[model samples]
Target: MVEDETDQVTLDLEQFEETKKEDTKPTLGDIFTDRVESLMKHRDIDNVLDDQQHILNNLEMMNEKLKFLNLISQSRYEASVTAFRFHMRLLSGVKKDLDSVFRRIRTLKTKLGVQYPEIMAEVQDKYTVHVSDDDDDE
Candidate 1:
């Protein structure tokens, strides 16, 4: 009958549609995105991002140092640089002796203050500089 033939035709059309969907090629955007994702994974893009972030942090630190140097006078800059170097040396010495049971944090800070009395004062002065600038009328 014609109804049976129509039903058969409809079933054939449905099967054809399913096959068409399955056989369709991916679009250009899909292929490009997939390739990029695969390349990023293969090249360890996460490590690259971490390295770039570290580099950015170093650059930011250097920028802050340059800004601080620009803000202060040359003599003060030199003094602060020297103090920072000495502070680092002191910290290194403390680190070396940290394993000893007798070394206390407060004791180390007290010794540093005694040896470089002006060091903490200079650090406080550096932090206060911005505050003073903000308070100025200009």
Candidate 2:
């Protein structure tokens, strides 16, 4: 009976050891899979660097495009300024011509006043064109 008890106790210890190993230890397949996942993460470093480089290249392209746009805008502004100055000079010359013409008409009206006084006032009022000079350039 003592021998039988000792055998039974040994069998129970063996069963308990098997159960503890199954419950507490990882399988070889699970360990290998975890190692492969760690290697894949290490390999993805290059992919992460490539992604950053691509983003930087795109940013450089956008910066170049913005520089081109700025150049175009500046040129347009310069052309507009040149055109405005040309128009201003042309208008100033036109104003001078108009002033001379008005002076000549007034002289003619004064000369004809002695010959026909009645028509002088009518011609002065009808033919004189008054232009206002409100230019910012003094």
Candidate 3:
């Protein structure tokens, strides 16, 4: 009977060990959860470096764009203004030349009128031109 009791105790110890092992063993879900927790706790340096590189590239592109805009504002705008001023001066000189030409033509006509008064009167009577307001009843 004593030997039977010792065997019974040995059997109970074996069963307890099996139950303890079953309770402590990790499942697939437990392992996945532990990995995710570990990853969350750790900081990855490569991602931070990538983000910094992106910011630097964006700033460089913006700097190049600003340089192009400055070129247009400085050289192109100043050149346009200078060209406009030159054209205006040229137009003014042309106007002065045209005025002098018209004055010379008027003086020549007066001299011809003074030389032949009777012939000018005959031509004027034949032409019969008039300047009217109301556009000739258009």
In the order shown, the candidates' Cα RMSDs to the true structure are 24.8, 14.9, 15.4
Sum up the clashes in candidate 3. Answer: 0
Candidates by TM-score, descending order: 2, 3, 1
- Model 2 RMSD in Å is 14.9
TM-score for each of the candidates: 0.35, 0.47, 0.45
Worst 10 residues of 2 by lDDT: 129-138
Better of 1 and 3 by lDDT: 3
Which runs of model 3 end up more than 4 angstroms from their true locations? 1-56, 121-138
lDDT of 2 at 74: 100
| Residue 54 miss distance in model 3 (angstroms) | 3.7
Best by lDDT: 2
Clash counts per candidate, in order, are 0, 0, 0
Q: lDDT of each prediction vs. the true structure?
A: 0.83, 0.90, 0.88
Q: What lDDT is reached at residue 58 by model 1?
A: 100
Worst 10 residues of 1 by lDDT: 129-138
Cα lDDT of model 2 overall? Answer: 0.90
Q: Write the per-residue lDDT of candidate 2 for residues 7-91, one digit (tens) a residue.
A: 9999999999899978887889979998988878765978989999999999999999999999999999999999999999999
Error of 2 at 43 (Å): 8.8
